[model samples]
Target chain A: MQVTLKILRFDPEKDKKAHFKSYEIEADPLDRILDALNTVKWYKDGTLTFRRSCAHGVCGSDAMRINGRNRLACKELVGDIGKKITIEPMLGFRILKDLVVDMEPFFEKYRSIKPYLINYEDPPATERFQSAEDREIFDETTKCILCGACSGSCPPFWSNSEFIGPAAIVNAHRFIFDSRDQGSDERIAVLSQSEGVFRCRTVYNCTDACPREIPVTKAIEQIKRVMLYNR
Target chain B: MYRGQSGMWLWVFHRLTGVGILAFLFLHVADTYLVGLGPEYYNELVFLYKLWVFRLAEWLLVGAVLYHAINGIRVVLMDFWESGVERHTQLVFGTLGLFLLLWLPAGIFMLKDVKWFA
Candidate 1:
């Protein structure tokens, strides 16, 4: 069957505004949307551009709006999305080109929360040990791949870019709840501010948009609870 | 435009109802202040509310307030409850069900005296 892919295209060098460019390509229902995109870029138009690394949803690349939802092109099948598919760059970010947005601002929020584990203690022989029960507290948040789907789908982030998005909070939760990590206090303080967890109105868009199936709003709520009770 | 699901629709309704309630509050305060001026002025203004159009708006206002209050409880539950996230969809439907249950009867009572059908 032939599939029609309507791509939102933007050429910063020449075009003043972005526009849609549709391409009809032969494809199997089982084929990934990424395959159709590749066919468009390789055969129909060399000017078409997008980002994809692992092409397996692990790398967190190729996250875009597929039929009005944030999803990975590589993981989404043409059959699942139907014959007519509309693709656009993820929301709440600067669109650099076709299907690619500048991820620096998104990464900046991630860095603000100190994503890495912060522990300053004497080494425990070889490595830090933690029980299975302790690990289970934050197990759901560890699956995040920073795909920007959750943050992009969020309305608060869309209206106010200053808001620390769900992705950052999820990353913070991973370390904040870890028994081996000792940075919960600092992280909680940073998230308690006006631009932090309070900005989240529990819209649950982040929870719906997560490609990794992370319980994003739940993690953010947990962080709120930690801040409230710890004080 | 983002094509979000039930959660998004709930958020949209929550926001709109909140704003609508606030607006009604302002209008109500302004109208009630007419009571301080004189009974004649106040009753004259209040008499306009008996019209069919204002009666319809009153029903809408009641619906808005009921939905907003019920959904607010749902949000609070989601924040504090451990399994709230997992049961969010169910909670959304429950909120709607409860809103209709309360609002429908209130609508019947509020509009009973209005002779719209007659």
Candidate 2:
């Protein structure tokens, strides 16, 4: 099948504004969008740039707006997307180049939530033990790959860059609900601020756009409930 | 345009209807305040509202308010119930269905007395 990949391209050194560049390539229906992108960069145009690692969707590096939705290129099959695909970098981020956005701000928000577990108690004899039920509470959030798909799809994050996005909240939820972790107080304080979980308008875009299938909006809502009742 | 699904459309509609309702509230407050200015000013404003254009706008306002109120309930449901998140798409469709159920009859009745294209 001949697929036309309409990619939003920008070259800081030359182009004054971003523009779409189309490339027609022969591909199998079962071929992943990442494969098509690889064909374009390797054969059609060497200047075509995108980020991809472990092109099996594990690394979460190749997330972009595919056909006006945030999706990992590696996971979306060309068969599902039809012949013509309009690809653009994720929204709510600075476009550093073609198909790449500056993720520094995103990571800073992730850092602000203190994503890692915080336990000041003495170390266990071997390791911290947790029952299966306790693990299940945050099991869904642990699948987050930080692909930025959910956060980028969010309208509030698009309108206000400072809004600590769904990704950060999901990361926070991971630690906040853990039975072994003891940082919920501090994390809740950070998330209860103006730019925090309240900024979410229950749009559910984050839940829809998650490549990992994380229930993002639900997690944020759960955080809201925790803050409300626990306080 | 982000080709988002039912959830996105609901959010967009909710926001637009909310803004529309707020604008109507401002207009309503100003019009109600006209009573203090005397019966003449208030009656004049009321007469203007009886015009066909304003009557049609009133129908739209009714629909907007209905949809916004119904969808607001959906948001509240989703916020409080875990199952609401799982069934949000259904809830959105249900909200729209309920809005249509209530708004259709109200709109028809509101516009029945208006003379259009006469």
Candidate 3:
């Protein structure tokens, strides 16, 4: 019938610091979390602010800390949350407002690893084609949508943000195992740097938070083993 | 090492400290190689090396080494020792405590002597 939502809100100027604000919402058992929040902002408080490019969890712009874990707001159901639902901005990022975190640092690390494929030669007149087996290796990695969920869930990134997190490494894996890419050695060399792949402790938090169900820890370890043998 | 687990964090810390040790090793070796760069460079190098910053770095280095060594033993025990399997987590904490025990006195001595080059 009714669920109490405790959301963390911070207005840099007005509040001067972060605090949790609670709101009551009445909705059906099947309503998505976004629907509940929308109901709250529409009728109760118009000052509530959060980012959502897609209400269906496709764009991943609604990733936040839901009940002490990193997840997309649109994906969580209000009925499923135990007791009280706690919403906060994603960890390990600069909170812009209520439930919104600046993801520039996460994107910077993604760009630092040269997330694009390093194709040595051009494709034919038509397009580049590959066997099913070859595509399978990188298929899971490509499912990542650059969401900051994994990086925020990582403990190492909490200590030192420079540690190229699992999200970036997973992006790199999409290219590292690409059959057309000729930069395996180059990517491995770059990753072997101090804060590169070696910084990963194989914590597997990335794998746990990945909504795409990609085998992130396995992919990172594969890159690690490549660096090891290649050296 | 997945979420809601213990050894996962420990393993991560161990490898991180391992990398820290490797970087320290490279820097230390490169600095020590200056001894062969003739006496004038060596004297200047030693003079600069014997500073408060260097002493602080030494303290951090000792901490890293102690962490790695103790964790490595935990790993080794996990690999060996018949009764160690059931007691693995306890062994990890025990050795980690041992490391702290050893590091505190070693650190005190280093600060008391106050000799960076020595």
Q: At residue B42, what lDDT does model 2 achieve?
A: 98
- Candidate 1 per-residue lDDT, tens place, A121-186, comes to 987788799999999999999999998999999999989989999999999999999999998888
TM-score of each: 0.96, 0.96, 0.69
TM-score (0 to 1) for chain A, all models? 0.98, 0.99, 0.95
Candidate 1: segments with Cα more than 4 A from true spot = none
- Least accurate 10 contiguous residues by lDDT in model 1 chain A: A222-231
User: A1-231, model 2: which lDDT tens digit per residue?
Assistant: 999999999998998989999999999999999999999999999999899999998999999999999999999999999999999999999999999999999999999999998999998999899999999999999999999999999999999989999999999999999999999899999999999998888887888899899989899999988887778
- Candidate ranking (lDDT, best to worst): 2, 1, 3
Specify the highest-lDDT model's number. 2
Ranking by DockQ: 1, 2, 3
Q: How large a fraction of the reference contact set does each model reproduce?
A: 0.65, 0.59, 0.09
The first chain of model 2 has a TM-score of 0.99
Tell me the lDDT of model 3 at B90: 84
Please give the distance, in angstroms, between residue A151's alpha carbon in candidate 1 and its true position after superposition.
Answer: 0.4
Error of 2 at A108 (Å): 0.3
Candidate 2 Cα misplacement greater than 4 A, ranges: B36-38
lDDT scores for all predictions? 0.91, 0.93, 0.78
After superposition, candidate 3 runs with Cα above 4 Å error: B1-118
lDDT score for residue A134 of model 2: 95
Evaluate candidate 2 and give its CAPRI docking class based on DockQ.
medium
